[model samples]
Target chain A: MVGIEPRVTSYLDYATGGFTTQYAAMLVAAGVCDTVACVFGANPRQATVGDSGAYVYDPTYGLVNAGAIAALGWTRYMSKYETVEEDLGAVAVTFRRHARLNPNSAFTEPLTLDDYLATPYTVWPFRELDICKVTAGGAALIITAADRAGDHPKAPVYIGAAGRQQAPLELAGDEHLMCYAMTSVAEQVYREAGIGPGDVDLLMATDSSTAAVIHTLENYGFCEPGGGGRFVREGGIALDGEIPMNPDGGQLSGGYLLGWLHQVEAVRQLRGECGERQVAGARIAQYATTGRWRTDFLSTIYVAE
Target chain B: MPDSVDIRANEANEAFEAFVGDHELRVQQCDGCGRRRLPPSWICPHCLAEEYEWIAASGTGVIHSFIWYLRPLDPAFLATPYNVTIVELAEGPRLISKVVGVQPGDLSVGQAVEAAFEDGPPGATTLVFRVRETADGAEG
Candidate 1:
């Protein structure tokens, strides 16, 4: 009851996190509404027994007799990115970074870059770290009129502007999976918000895949396309940088609960509730939702005084 | 197994057939404001003009950008990594097509390309394109 309706159900088998993120971001940017409630879950009981007791849960389980959700993540990698190595690389980097600061996170042990590189490949491009752990949790939000937001217990956060855009849905038919959609959405969002990349204070994006976070930053006008990886390497998105990103450890470090937690965290930041992880003097924040193999996206801008 | 099969065309796609008959790619261009329409339009996208004209494209251009798919979203194109490229045609229009006959790593920005059609199920032919070597003997 705290968020929007229709739930924006996406078949995990056919849909990508990028698509869901973009859908949420665009809806907010278009002024249709500000604030969205995102929910993500999987039935771990539907998982299949694999090597080392690891289970795979299939999003299309009732429809398709595949493995567990973990297996589905593997198949997505095999069919989408082609190599498990690349997929695992994305997962490992995200998890290792997130585990350092997240107390509620499921996997909290410190992971070295070498441990991530050496983790067994669950799918060619995906590893245990590359895939999101299938957990049962639900999250919600309240998106209301920004001007009248201060009436609530939390201070009002203004949704300054938002943008949504997509490429052809079919991955094979898209111009490029690694680029395109994010850049287009970013250009439109910046135009609508009437601000430049340097004006942003922080970012809360759907980090389903490592490439997704990097590419989205580039596409959102922070950096040029293909420069996302370099941005991460340069610590550009860190807490102390000119533009901070995913201060809450994102979906990678924070468990996956659709993207509802992202919205909640953004609100928390606007209200100055985040301890230690807070970016000081933060006033404006950006959140990007991406899907359809990085070819579809939506972005929203928020301002809090 | 074949990756995809084209189904029969419906009445809404008769113009697509005329394009195949002439071996020309035809898109509706708005006469009122000179905007090229895609997905076929009944009215001009820019000025909402009911009037339009059929224009033939030169079908030659450079690859403005591209991406290689290691995995197949469609069961049909699963075995091979397909290259999807955006071609900036000589007519100043951009079209999306599969870049055939090139390795994924070999692709470069501004690569020259040409459009081609793949015959689909009865009366339906999908447009596909391939990269071409440059006039100066440079392979893209």
Candidate 2:
């Protein structure tokens, strides 16, 4: 029993709702969770509005509710089913067709779906390929004791449970009338990880937009919230399918740091060390985080045995 | 003539003519739970109510969202890209103006605006909202 999820503690009122209430008070100040799991998403100064009119600034159409779009805090659970032009043109055409099959993608050339619908609207249903860019990264994680799995060198993943929820700060004044609180924190993290989102395989969430990663893969019940734009327009979540989300090009082609490097690439694809963005025999991964507009929720349930 | 900048421009032009002699864009309104208050309240933020009610706005509204800045984060707003909105008001409150004549690809979403004011840097005034012509006359 050595689980130690530190995940950034009090970085000076980092303010994205004080960095998920200081990373759930630094996972109960380090003795790693007697119960600590604060989560967050949608942070551009908490979906900005400060020209100071209090809440809801316009200064010329910056965020006029579609539930105050910053990609509705997880793309409003991918708009409960999809259609901001088919979940932003199928994730900017499947990340420009997987950045033409990866080249450390910072945008691997040819993008067209009319260049993701001519880019620029930043919110009204979303544009600029449905948001998420800001970069400058850092990531770290370490959790011990799955019966001290053969004393380290990589091979112990089992946590199997973690759930968090928040939702009220006067709900950002009905944050433009709600819906996507990651579908009740993905129904209490799949009923406290009793597991069954098709018994998971790999997901590493918190996209920050592309409609909150197609409504968090349809709020983690894995495809149902508007069926995540026909489950990513068929092909299910492509890297190989059946589960493969954010095989790294997440945070929109991998960069946005607020997701702690998508939870350090889900502990490097459960330690197989993601060489070509791995995802082979993954055994039940899942990591979720969203806050503010998605209303602060987090989830974790690893298992590589 | 710095007698403390002429007694701070005669106490801010007598608090801007007691808020335009009550046509009321005076703002404060939070007597605790009415909201419309901003940078002036003595305490009330939804029920803390120290008591306030300078209210008057019906100065009209719309816009609801906007952006244009083009790239100026301020070099004195570099040759003006401006626009910036979020109006709302029909007195239910929203605020954050300065739209002017419209351009940044002709900003749509509800349009119609009003409340102007201006005159800062001395007797100080500053409210800024423009893009008008609606009460049915059209042009949003």
Candidate 3:
């Protein structure tokens, strides 16, 4: 932060959904500024569950983001492939389990596959467990040049690569349901980082819905498209599996700080500061987010240095 | 529909609203590329052509995707377990609307659907879809 003195020469504000931290880091890398502070806060608790209820009513269509995502999830995955409830439930259950180890997480209780399945569907094909809890909070990140990092007390996580893409016209076309934009961004970031899915030790994905976790894995090439359901169900994303995802519990069980928390967790994981939930010998960490209604997608690779 | 006056309409979508008011379904057809797009836009996405015309749709399509809400996200939605569907028009564009004349469990992808309209608040009318009847007179 430039502080009350206002010594900073330039200021850039991002109202553009998630990926705030990554974009801020990019500014530092580009020499736009020696340091940048990215701040985020959301208080959608009342609006999401309250009087307005996150539903956007056009003259004819009454649409909610959660409901639309649920429909898209089923349309994209279940319609074409043979998938079970466990395929989707695994994401919620695993996140809650990881949350049990995260002291900062509000959702401390253990969630089993059965418990997830028992939850009622607020929207068909999406249980209450599948959606994120609307919480009010603030998160901030201080991104500085690599040379400045040596002055800090804590180990710095270097930004290896960053990529973001906005879907054409926000909500037009089938890209939102199909993860076409997500794949494009993921490929760009992975290439820039000179690594594949196998090289990353941890993945912190913004899980606004369980369906998002499944889609993220597929879009990032962690697994084949349409195979995410089976991969997650088979424990590929578990803590001891091939790739540990959302070790700090992600948005499903972690507080939904509009994806800022994922960046925070990714940095912390690469720094090896997480206590019980930490992945041993972690080097490369990946953080990703698909913006509200899948309108945009972003990925960043962070490595311990 | 909730009457909060929060309708998201502008110059780009005005043509669609006028057609639905007249109980007809139409989409924007690019004059240069012979392609169609909906939720009405000024330029063709495929060709970036500025000139376009509104042409009547066949009013027939297949159920592309759908979902049923167990509870209304907005209080104005009167019924429970109501379905919202996206219909992929035969002319090659998708529209978000509701499908009537069938139960939620019975509705499936690829079912034949045709355009239907309902009166909305004031001058506006809502565009919806219904399952087309099969040759034997059964609901499609």
lDDT for each residue of candidate 2 in A1-305, tens digit (9 for 90 to 100): 26766544444333332244335435654756544334433334522221111134333233332224443333233323335476557775775565455444444567766778776554344555555555443444444444545676777566666666666443222232233555666677678777777888888776556656665676566876466777786767777877777777765665565666666666668877877667887878888766545556667777776
TM-score of chain A of each: 0.70, 0.31, 0.90
Q: Tell me the tens digit of each residue's lDDT in model 3 across A127-209.
A: 77777776666777788998898898888888898888888753325578765688888888889999999999999887877
Pick by lDDT: which candidate is best?
3
Ranking by lDDT: 3, 2, 1
Runs of candidate 1 with Cα error greater than 4 angstroms are A1-96, A103-136, A143-201, A208-229, A252-258, A269-285, A288-305, B1-12, B73-77, B135-137
Per-candidate interface DockQ score: 0.04, 0.07, 0.45
Pairs in steric clash, model 3: none
Q: Model 3, stretches more than 4 Å misplaced?
A: A1-18, A42-59, A170-172, B1-12, B75-78, B120-122, B138-140
Best-matching candidate per TM-score: 3
lDDT of each: 0.57, 0.57, 0.77
Per-candidate TM vs. native? Answer: 0.59, 0.35, 0.90
**Model 3: share of true interface contacts reproduced:** 0.48
Stretches of candidate 2 above 4 Å error? A1-68, A71-110, A117-128, A131-207, A210-247, A251-261, A264-266, A269-272, A278-290, A294-305, B1-26, B29-49, B57-85, B88-104, B108-140
- Fnat of each prediction, in sequence: 0.00, 0.04, 0.48
